[model samples]
Target: MKPIFDEPEQYQSAVAKTAEALISKFGKLADGKAWEAARMPNLTRSERAYCEAVAVRVTRLVRGGSVPA
Candidate 1:
């Protein structure tokens, strides 16, 4: 699929930024699973919906496709 960014440089930068943010927020991707586990119980229905939307956005952004692969 075509990249979401206009150029390779932009794509690399976007990936780097995503990685950096993930690292900052959760130390590493492993922590992401932990975070998800910790967050599940406290989510209200509306909060859960918002989280699902954000997950879909992130998936599309990284996969460079609007629809799920």
Candidate 2:
């Protein structure tokens, strides 16, 4: 199916919105579970990639390192 976000700006906006929602829901301590939850089947490849990046950034900011063991 065709993705909703065709333009780069639209994609970025969607990614930022997803990240903000995840951060708000999971708080500063967003873990691997949060990242997993963000992975919806409907997301396009680029959206998933951006979400992964946000997850990593959030994890680093919260734990000051990679995700916990």
Candidate 3:
């Protein structure tokens, strides 16, 4: 598939920024698995939905297309 960014530089910057944000918020990516598995009963309905939406967006961007081999 075509790249999301027009050039490699833009793609690299986007990747770095996203990685830094994720790491800052959650230490390592493996921690995310445990976090997802953990309970969160305190969240209201809207908050839960918003969290789910953000998770979906992050998942898509992380797992989406790649540089051609």
On TM-score, the leading prediction is 2
Residue lDDT tens for model 2, 1-69:
656555666765665566557667777656565577558778878777777766766666556665322
Q: Look at candidate 1 and give me any clashing residue pairs.
A: none
Per-candidate Cα lDDT values, in order, are 0.49, 0.64, 0.49
lDDT of 1 by residue, 1-69 (tens): 664444656545554455445545654342344346336988877555444444444444444556432
Summarize candidate 3's per-residue lDDT along 1-69 as a digit string, tens digits. Answer: 765345666655554555446646665462364236233778767555444444444454455634232
Better model by TM-score, 1 or 3? 3
Candidate order by TM-score, decreasing, is 2, 3, 1
What's the residue-level lDDT of 40 in candidate 1? 92
Task: Give model 3's clash tally.
Answer: 0
How would you order the candidates by lDDT, starting with the best? 2, 1, 3
What C-alpha lDDT, on a 0 to 100 scale, does residue 27 get in candidate 3? 53
